[model samples]
Target: MANHKSAIKKIRSDERKRLRNRYQHKTARTHIKKLLTTKDKEEAQLLLKVVHGMIDKLTKKNIIHKNNAARKKSRLAKYVNKLVATA
Candidate 1:
C-alpha cells in the first residue's frame, strides 16, 4: 500500500499508463496479425507500412525497445517480400 500521498498519486498515474500501454500494444499486435494474414501482396505491403509506423511510434514512446521494434519490422518485411515473390 502506498502510505504517502505522493506515492498514491504515483500509483494512480502508473496504473493509467499501464492501461494505455497495454491498449497500444494490443492494437499493434492486431495490426501485425492482420498484415501477416493478408494474402494480397499489395494489401499486405500497405498494412506493413502502417504497422511499421505504429512500431516506430511505440519505440519513440518507450513502450517497446527500439531494437525489438526493428527486429519485428525486419521479420515482417521479410515475410511480406517472400509473399510478394511467391505471388
Candidate 2:
C-alpha cells in the first residue's frame, strides 16, 4: 500500500499505461498472426504495409523495441517474398 499521495497516483498511472500497452501489443500480435497465415502474396503485401505502420507507431511510443519491430518486419517480408516465389 502506497502511503504517499504521489505514490498512489504513480501506481494508478502505471496501471493505466500497463493496460494500454498490453492492448496495443496484443492487437499487433493479432495482425502479425494474420500476416503469417495469409497465403496470397498481394494481400499479404498490402497487410504488410498496414502492419509495418502499426509496428513503427508502437516502436515510436516505446511499446515495442526498435529491434523487435525490425525483426518482425524482416520475417514478414521474407514470408511475403516466398509466397511470390512459390507461385
Per lDDT, the best of the predicted structures is 1
Clash pairs, model 1 backbone? none
Q: For candidate 1, what is the total of clashing residue pairs? A: 0
TM-score list, all predictions: 0.91, 0.90
Off by over 4 Å in 1: 85-87
TM-score of 1: 0.91
Q: Write the per-residue lDDT of candidate 2 for residues 1-87, one digit (tens) a residue.
A: 999999999999999999999998899899999999998888899999989998998999999889999999898888988896335
Best by TM-score: 1
Clashing pairs in 2: none
